[model samples]
Target: MRIGELARLTAVSERSLRYYEEQGLLASTRTPGGHREYPPASVDRVIRIQELFAAGLNSATIAELLPCMRDVDGGPGENATPWLEQELVAQRDKLDRAIGDLERSRQVLDEVIKAATGR
Candidate 1:
């Protein structure tokens, strides 16, 4: 399919798709007229890329990890490298800390609300 079709199917912007290609995270073939043509599986690839980015992985790290990873039922898989595993562990630790901090903040907010309104 064309880039536009891939974008529609994946719900990713065309600009982001182009950026993925530019970052070497995605690949596309050129048609005879030089239009970008993507494989159907690109939809899953785009989703995986978004997930890695959400995990705080940079584009370069994503580019390195994509080949060793798979999008299985919207989950990450085939993670076979020690470095990648370590990175994932670090990201999880960071996420856990952020979640804990948010939870504490929410509790403080609840206390303030209860104290101010006597409710």
Candidate 2:
């Protein structure tokens, strides 16, 4: 499939997809006309890439961890090693801290909204 098709299917922008390619988190081939050609596997790969990014993992970390990721099932696949498992633990800790921070922020916002609305 073409980049655009993959982007639409994945709900990721074409520009981000290109960026992923540049970061080596994704792989693609070029058509004879010089346009990008992605295989069907790229769909899940892109989703996995996005998930890792959402966990606050940088592109380099994501690149290193990609092979350890499983699609659809959203678990660590057989490609996982001791090193990658350690990285996952660290990333998960980061994400947990971020979630707590956001929850606190949301509670503050709720209070502000209630005070302003006199509710």
Candidate 3:
């Protein structure tokens, strides 16, 4: 698919897709006319990339961590266990902090609404 179609499929902007390419998070093949052509699996990859970014993993870390997401049997490589476990733990901690922040923000909004409505 083309970049536009990939963006739509991935629910990401075209600019983001291009930026992902620039960040080395995504790869595409150029057509004879210089247009980028992405495989269908790029959609899933884009979604995964967005999730990783949302979890507070930077691009470089994501690039390293993506390869670690294989089956338990390690079809990709056996050496990814230690690094993958550490990275995943770090990502989880970051996500927990974000969730706590969001909960606090929600509570504040709830207080504001209750005050405004005299509840």
Model 3 per-residue lDDT tens digits across residues 3-118: 99998887899999999999888899999999999988788789888888887788998888876665323345434678788879987987898899999999999999999999
**What C-alpha lDDT values do all the predictions have?**
0.87, 0.89, 0.84
lDDT digits (tens) for residues 1-119 of candidate 1 = 99999998888999999999999999999999999999877888999898888888799988887877756465555665677767678878988999999999999999999999998
| Model 2 misplaced regions, further than 4 Å | 73-78, 97-119
What is the alpha-carbon lDDT of model 1 when measured against the actual structure?
0.87
lDDT of 2: 0.89
Candidate of highest TM-score? 2
lDDT digits (tens) for residues 37-119 of candidate 2? 99998898898899888878899998888887666566557686788878899989888999999999999999999999987
* Native-to-model Cα distance after best TM-score fit, residue 46 in candidate 1, in Å: 1.4
lDDT, candidate 2, residue 11? 98
TM-score of each: 0.74, 0.74, 0.69
Best-first order by lDDT: 2, 1, 3
RMSD of 3: 4.4
Compared with the true structure, the alpha-carbon lDDT of candidate 3 equals: 0.84
